[model samples]
Target: MKKDYNFGYTKVNSKQKTKLVQNVFSSVAPSYDIMNDLMSLGMHRLWKKRFVEIMDIKENDIILDVGSGSGDIAREILKENLLTNLYLLDLNKEMLFEGKNRLKKEKNIKYFIGNAEKLNFKNNFFDKYTISFCLRNVTEYLLSIKEAYRVLKPGGKYCCLEFSTPKSSLISSTYKIYKSKILPFLGEVIAKDKNAYKYLSESIDLFPSQEELRKNLLDCGFTNVETINLFNGIVAIHTGYKL
Candidate 1:
């Protein structure tokens, strides 16, 4: 039997795990953007800005921003006038809808309500693939990685922005305090859902570290796997080339 994962470090199997994640995001969709600001102290926006700014996108590049919640990354890239063949994909329909609503004015942007593990796209389809702040929720990380690679054109770039463990013990301790106590409190007060925030904080600890993540990308046949850390490794941008 194939293994599936739950956010609480429990084993459930991939299919069930996917359903669980969809439920989670659906529950939090309404307050997703606000919670991001509260949890990251609005640094999430800056982080995305920096992430996209570094991509150096070219004209006519077919880019897919998977797990694109509320279209923040897509909006930033489009606003910069970087590319036109931008596709926004997400597992949670509600989250995708949110992105759609925000990006509707940009009529050229494409949208897909789909799974990351089994991408609903053709092979060698995208020039650049990006998954931001959503991998930790994916039911199968390796499959998602492979799907990103499979959909990319030769020499295409793959980028991921995700939570990671801090390198410094001091910073880790401080972050632990904030995630464990402060985040849940804010979630309860603002989103009226303490458990949702609690799951998110715990999920961070379950996520792979920088080195492990690099190896995973490498194992999926990605080359030049590199990571750029931010906020003392609370999050990182992992980039690789499909060669």
Candidate 2:
């Protein structure tokens, strides 16, 4: 049977989609964090902080951060001393390598090379699962959400922070120009990977709307799904519980 795949705006063959995404992340891995800060004016940190605050992490909780590029979200969780175990998982080795180097001496963090759509962990293994700016890049968002649901314990929280379209026409238009023009240019100069940044912008524009994503989380077995718009709807944090 010929497998069907969905990549952003178009449908593609399933067998090749993973490789395509892998290539994109690999190309941008070296300067992903730097470019993120540049593109978002360091608001990514504030957005991640909101995610952590809303989760209200507890001590001795095992937290899993999927698509954890450079361990930014994990580091934020660790800083609060609310987590007993922090697992940073990503498909791109380069991204994990950068994270590992940044936290070589940290005892609580463990890096794992794994796909979000096919987590290797046993059921009910994590107290919380969080992803930042990554859900949009996944080839199968619902599958990844299902994986998160499988790994999280009952009553555990699942939070995702991702880019979304702004509601205001004026703001949306201005932001679109910046993303399509300024972001890629800065990414090329800093990351030296123009194509990767181009893909990032394109992916954000092509991703599902906030309401659609909330429904996706519900479809994947999440309960009480809610979305909180940040930065004037330019980004949103979606939270749900496994009941």
Candidate 3:
């Protein structure tokens, strides 16, 4: 007997998929941030900045930054002095360590190794839940959303920044060329993991569109769900309130 897992647009057996994803990240973790800038031409920074700007962060906010690779999102939030407790959770221990090392001086931060589909947190505990550039990579992304809702306090905000399909024909066509041709090339050259970067590029088109994702959030017990597309839908910031 075997169970299937999604690795980008393709499905594989559960163990196989998990191993592949782990290997991919472990191979790229050291060069991950660099490749991001090269691959996206630095647009990812703007997308992240916009996502953080929209978060309704208040004083003493307890935030769970799920899939917080290298702690960039967590650091951005902490820089604003908006959080009293900031938890950085990632499935991969290597990524968690990278975050811990980067944010070593931060006293209010904690790192945890946890799965998104099954987060180890108390219900109604988090004031904000942020998952950036990571939702689609989860084997059970929908379940992850439900788990996010479970942990968020009433009126808590759930926000995500994820790659999405472009709505415009011109931008979409241009993007296709870049991801298919340039992304993997840059990956091989920079990260020495061509396949890993290939998988990342492939996952973008496999992601749910903005409206469909909004509906998923609504179905998962979220309210006031909305999305703001960036760069004509190359990415989007989806947010909802748990009420």
Candidate 4:
């Protein structure tokens, strides 16, 4: 007999983790966008906007948005009018369905139910790859990075936007209070899933620090790795170029 693996926060069986994650997303899929707006006070939009602007996409570019929930980043990418092919990949079918419904009118986009650690894309297929607030939830962080590198064209860019620990001690302390207390309460009220919200908050704490993530990207064969701390280091955008 094998001892069951328990993921912290959820403490769910290893076999059930995927289903639990899917259920969590499915339950929140309808109100996901609204919850994001509320949780971040509409700042996520700005962060994403800035992320797209920094990419400086060109016409006919192929872009992949992994963990693209509700197609928010995909919509922003389409607004650029530069991307001819936009692929939205997520593990949760419900999230992908919501994104598909939201982006039904956009002919340039496609949705795929896929895992980040094992992408179903050809090697060197994309001009740019981006995952906003998605990397932390991936089952295998380093494998995902390696797969991202493997799928990008030569010199292609891989960008990730995620919550990060604040540098300022005072701000960090204050943020912690909100994350541990208020965030779960808000989730219970809005998304009606306090456990999932708690998991999200805890995941941020477990995620790699900025310096460690930068080194991971470099170790995964990414060149020019850099990080941009946002909103007083509460969030960070990490960028790297595949050589």
Instruction: Compute each candidate's TM-score over C-alphas.
Output: 0.96, 0.94, 0.96, 0.94
Residue-level lDDT tens digits of model 2 in 92-178 = 898889889888888978889999999999999898999998888787778999999999999999999999878889999998898
By TM-score, the better pick of 3 and 4 is 3
- Name the regions of candidate 4 deviating beyond 4 angstroms: 1-14
User: Which residue pairs clash in candidate 1?
Assistant: 4-13, 4-14
lDDT tens readout by residue for model 1, 180-232: 99988998999888888888888998999999999999999999999999999
For model 2 the TM-score comes to 0.94
Q: Using lDDT as the measure, what is the rank order of every candidate, best first?
A: 1, 3, 2, 4
Off by over 4 Å in 3: 1-3
TM-score result, candidate 3? 0.96
Model 4 worst lDDT window (10 residues): 1-10
lDDT of 4 by residue, 145-206 (tens): 99999999998999999888789999999999988998889899999899878877887887
**lDDT (CA) for every model shown?**
0.88, 0.86, 0.88, 0.86
Clashing pairs in 4: none
Q: What is the C-alpha RMSD of each candidate to the true structure, in Å?
A: 1.2, 1.6, 1.4, 2.0
Best by lDDT: 1
Ranking by TM-score: 1, 3, 2, 4
